[model samples]
Target: MTVAGEWIEKITGPFEDKKRYREYKARTKLLPESHRTAVEALDRYLMYFGSIGKSDVLLRMVDDLIDLFERAAADGTPVRDVVGEDPVEFAEEFLANYADGMWINKERDRLRRAVERAAGEESEKEGESPR
Candidate 1:
C-alpha cells in the first residue's frame, strides 16, 4: 500500500535525473590514485554535509571537483597541497561558495519567517514580503 506522498515524491524527488552523477563517478575513476582518494574523502563529506538541493548545481559542483583533481593529477601536485591539512575546512569552504544550492539555505529562510511571525514583525497577510 503505497502512500500518496510516496507516489508524489517518486515523481518529484531530488536526483531523479542521475546521468550527471554517473558521469561524475566515471570521471573520478580516471584520476590518479592519491587524487582519487582525496576526491572520495571530499565526496563523502559533501554527501553528508553539502546538502545541495538543486540537481544542476550539484552536477556543476561535482564536475568542478573532478576538474580540480584532474588538473592536480596532471600537474603531479600532491594531494595534501590540493586539499590542505584541514580537509573538513577545505570541503566546507568549497560548499560555502555554492550556498544557493544548499538545503540549509531554505531552512534558514523558514526559520527567519517563523521568528519574524513570532516577534510580530511579519503578518498573516498573503502578500507580505519574504524578508
Candidate 2:
C-alpha cells in the first residue's frame, strides 16, 4: 500500500469495518435460532477481544464465521457440536487461524524482541565481571 493509503487507514479505516460487520449481522439473522444465538455470542466475543487491526482480515474472518454458522444451521448441527464443549477454547482457536492484523500478536512479537535484547545485555554484563 502507498504511504497515503496507510495514512488513510490510520486516519479511520474508512469506517468500513462497521459496514462489513453489519453485513455479517444481517446474514447471521437468517440462521436458525440456536445457531444464530451461538454465532452472535461468539461474534460479540471476537469483536471485543479479537484485537484484529486490518479491515480486510476482519472482513474475511466475519465472512468465514457466517459461512460456518450457515452450514451448521443447514445441517441442523447442535451448537455444542459446532463449538465443542469449551466455547472460549473454540473461539481462541478460531481466532488463531486468522492471524492477520492481530494486535496481540504484534505486542507479543514486541515483547519477545525486548526480552531477547535484555537477555543479551545481561549476558554482556555478566561477561564483563571480574573472573
Best by TM-score: 1
The residue-by-residue lDDT of candidate 1 on 10-79, one tens digit each, is 7765444576788789999988888988998899999789889787788888989999999999999999
Candidate 2 lDDT by residue in tens digits, 1-131 = 88988898788766577787788889999888899999889989988889888888888998998999899888888899999999999998999888876988888988987786666754555675322
Clashing pairs in 1: none
Kindly give the stretch of ten consecutive residues in candidate 1 with the minimal lDDT sum. Answer: 8-17
Off by over 4 Å in 2: 1-12, 15-18, 121-131
Per-model TM values vs. the true structure: 0.78, 0.78
lDDT per prediction? 0.85, 0.85
**Candidate 1 TM-score, true structure as reference:** 0.78
TM-score of 2: 0.78
